[model samples]
Target: MFQGFNLNVSNESRFDSPSTYDEILKSREDNVRESLENFYNEEGLLNGDSLRKEWFPEIENCHVFISHSSKDRELALKLANWLYHEFKIESFIDSTVWGFADKLLKQIDNKYAYREETKDYSYEIRNYTTSHVHMMLSNALNSMIERSECLLFLNTENAIRNISLKEDREQYTFSPWIMAELQTSALIEKKQSPNSQRPFGSLESNKTDIESIVKRAKSFQMIHKANVEHLNNITCENLSEWAKDCNGEKGYNALTTLYRDYAPGCR
Candidate 1:
């Protein structure tokens, strides 16, 4: 499966080599930087500021932000790894640090302990409703979405559901984090280009949630009708057919297709 996805097969060797997780992450980061540099050099824009400016007028940093439910962290990581190795496209998933931090915060009540230890009335002057940890997480996630060239939402039935209640009908809500990322991406996209037709895309093995989410997004003017594609609709009987149809001639897989739709001029 890894070979079919074009991931680094040597990862098995590395796993056997006793490398630390931090070391693996560092190596991946270095590989991404090298790949991007090579891409820029091949395009003759490595040293030409003006040429680079013209080539990427709107996109400053080209990277994909993968938004998925915490329950699907492993699947999200697999997709991100495939994206980096196969397409040389940098992808970001917040679970690496966010999940760890969240777990640590839950394990230790340091924030509340600090508040009690200080007892400084002036500290209460802070206006945020949520805890400091949550505020930091929200900021970090919003920053990632803002910096990303495209937001690829991994749609699962668990992540999104249709609420039939009248109160919920007025405002469509998915997983809180997913909703935040989508809204943040939409805000950034609108700020950058108010007239952009589609600011994001979604992928799902099932169509029910995708259709509902897309409809809700369009009703709120977050995404365009033509921007989203149902991946299951494009499946094929054979591998070659799958590659040709699902993965386009230029190798626009489900994720890359979203990036292309949002940023046409981006490489």
Candidate 2:
């Protein structure tokens, strides 16, 4: 992904980089776009050729529901971004969409008053999606849940487990078909808490480089903070290790000087 040994990776987003690993590997952009495009064309799942086409989410039965406790909204958004950009997955969150939809509805009904003298008038009708557009979105959302191969819950395992498609708030909001469709969904837990993992390369890679990093006289603490500044100089093993180590420590010292942090005290 970093453009490897022989060439420089054109400083573009890693997600957009060319796969170029081998003749068989497709470029990242092409791969993601193909996954999205083939969703309608190849399988006949969406049955294209309509004059008015809407956004057809890929991943059959895999309409990714961003299930998270209200506390994790920020993290949920971040996860949604990654899922959409990295995996070309469909991620729908109600946060931004709800706000915009609400504002539009208010403007249409309240702002344009037919009566100049009275504050109240004909009815407070809200501007909403065209029936066709609403139906399209409804079908897409339901299809996402129905054909969903997997379900990604953002740090809400307990809530998701306790959820009832038959008699729950979620079920009440969406139609019965949509709720029932979630039964086929399989949950995939990310498991890494924001404060837990360092969010970088794996840990085993760091084990091998710990000896060299120590030999180089860098602070053992600095080596483990998961800084991307000297990323090329460190191995993933140590970084993941540090993040894991840091998860429970009272202070910075508790994070460093673990058995894995040193290699025979050459320093």
Candidate 3:
């Protein structure tokens, strides 16, 4: 185990050396976020041009939220600067010193025309900033979901993993010791993604939730019908074009039947 800097990875930390990917992750969880910072240092992990041109509230331009356990502020700041240098990523760090949200809201309220209305806007701004900070934490934990990606997690476990830290009581206590929000994001992606096959069976056998599937089917039907009609309309520019020749009803029925057969809840 390569031990240096402020912290040391003892035998109790994990097996042997940081040879495998999981071992590397487990080692970095020990308040040493250097590994996490290094991952994003990749050449094109965060493409500034594409981020600005394609993604809204662009990562290349927008500030990232950095949520750190107060004890790990130094590591958080180091990580934040790392992001800024490589991808032009602006990181908002929340630390024991000062959570960025409160500071940002104060700045915003100071500039707001409505002094009395600042109270409500203050609350809203504060919440929004706080949310980003939390998002930063979540993103660090699950590298699979970029804060940019349409990865919407409604119900899930906290992104950070618990680490046993010796406390004042001389006993072990589990704390959120994770520093790599990106790795955590990756893990979440693993969970959210559909793995076709596993040792036990396919994902289909154990499925429960179906609303998202139904909604997807409905959306696909709409897109498919529109594409079909558009192609036909472009191919034949007749003034006498009518629905009877277009098979609009049949297309609708086929789409409806196909959806009903598989998507139970689609209306």
Best candidate according to lDDT: 1
What local lDDT does model 1 show for residue 244?
37
Q: How close is every model to the real structure, measured as TM-score?
A: 0.46, 0.29, 0.22
Q: Write the per-residue lDDT of candidate 2 for residues 183-241, one digit (tens) a residue.
A: 32322122211222322101343445545644774333111111111112223344345
* lDDT tens readout by residue for model 3, 60-163: 22233443445555444454443333333344343321332234334434444213432223446545644644454333333322332211111101222323
TM-score: which is higher, 2 or 3?
2
Q: Number of the top candidate by TM-score?
A: 1
Using TM-score, rank the candidates from best to worst.
Answer: 1, 2, 3
lDDT of 1 by residue, 1-267 (tens): 000010112121221212222344544333322112333455555343332222222222335666766776765566555445444455567665454334433323333222443332123433332354455566767766666654556555444544546454322334556666655654454233221233332123434754575488646523112112212121112222323343533222444453343333333
lDDT of 2: 0.32
Q: RMSD in angstroms, candidate 2?
A: 22.5
* Error of model 1, residue 185, in angstroms: 1.5
- Candidate 3 regions exceeding 4 Å error are 1-68, 76-100, 111-187, 190-267
Name the 10 consecutive residues with the lowest summed lDDT in model 1: 1-10
